[model samples]
Target: MTEQQETPPTGVSKALQKDIPQATVARLATYLRVLAVLADEAVAIVSSEELAVAAGVGSAKLRKDLSFLGPNGVRGVGYDVIKLRDRIEDVLGLSEGHRVVLVGAGHLGRALVGYGGFRRRGFAMVGLFDNDPAVIGTSVTGLIVRDVAELTDAVAALEPTIAVITVPDAAAQGVCDLLVAAGLQCVLSFSALALEAPATVEVRRVDLAVEMQLLSFERARNAESAAEEAMSAAAGALLPRVSMTTSKGAVVQP
Candidate 1:
């Protein structure tokens, strides 16, 4: 995958005008999602510690992430949920309501369209496309699946902010090229292969297998560490205790 340049969006605050770290940007998304849940539950204010726990991050880390957007929470009262949510939304460009076009109406694509969270999160589903004859012309979650040939035309008409590619690994690059040629500036791909695109176009790949492998590695490492600690404790328990005897002693023990 190509490295993405850290360029701030236009019209952002001076603090945000400077490039935000990619890792921090990812954490901001998590914070935004947590804040959305808080908003739905009618939470007015949440302490930094509470938000950090909810988002699975350290309190200091959460505060530092929010700092990139400038001052957020009141020191005494905690963060105002709605205010913080809006600030994160603005910084992450969610306020713009991005329109999305997804190709590959297979299982993954179908599931993605059926997801209501996308619309709730301000991502509009503009089009769905696939090359399979059986899948074409079918409706998935109110959006008709168009043929791959119609991709460029649909992209032209829909003007999607992002295109999603979930086609098979073999067809992934071809689909990516079509989307790029259709003038799409951003793409989110679920295909296993790393897609090739010009630097001007941003492509993000999500490989489920790689993620699962990472989880497996962490689990194995933790298990190994636990076993080593157990062995160390057992060895300490087996150590002989030191004993002392006095001159006239009937057996003295220490």
Candidate 2:
């Protein structure tokens, strides 16, 4: 009997052909951000260990992630930081600028508009919208806020693919509905409440409390490490040092 040839998995094949993992793609985007900062300082090369530390990943994991994008690093040396940065930018679909619209003109909305990271990362804020009449005429980050009544018109005019919601929990669903109606494909929400979105629309939530909890955990770990070091030092001082000479005249300390 003849054996049947095995076909490769489509998703894995496509991802491999693109030379990246879904997870690695996300991390590479983060690494690219850090690399951009280093490149601005004129730094040339960075080792996986250093890059991993900067990107908050294990060195081995970082290497594996980069490997998905093909053999990029030199043995015994390191990766060319700028080259890796550019490669990641191309792979993650950030090489070309993307248009984004902001919903809500509150503090978070204003901060998102004023954020330099999005601009640095190749995202363009083409429009800002709010329901309040006062905020509608106000200027934010050089762009005037328009009324929510103009949401559809503004999105249609700007042709934005991404929408950011910074409204209150109660208004989040309504804002999302308007964004969907405006033809937005993706959303980045800052509201504390979870929102139900259509399968076609991708929503990424940025919860403040989740980040604060992570920070609190980090502080606790650091405090524990310091306490352990202090305890070790005190214990070491209490121990008496004894030296003995063996038959070979080699001295050993106990």
On TM-score, the leading prediction is 1
TM-score of each: 0.85, 0.76
The window of 10 residues in a row where model 2 has the poorest summed lDDT is 245-254
Give residue 19's lDDT in candidate 1 (0 to 100): 73
Backbone collisions counted per model:
0, 0
Global lDDT of model 2: 0.78
Q: Cα miss at 228, model 2 (Å)?
A: 6.4
For candidate 2, lDDT tens digit of each residue in 70-108?
Answer: 547798799898888877776666667789999889998
Q: Could you give me the TM-score of model 2 versus the true structure?
A: 0.76
- lDDT (0 to 1) per candidate: 0.83, 0.78
Q: Which stretches in model 1 have alpha-carbon errors above 4 Å?
A: 1-18, 237-254
Candidate 1 residue-wise lDDT at 209: 82
lDDT of candidate 1 over 168-254, digit per residue (tens): 999999999999999999999998788999999999998788867766766676677567667868887544323522222221111
Clashing pairs in 1: none
What is model 2's C-alpha RMSD?
10.4
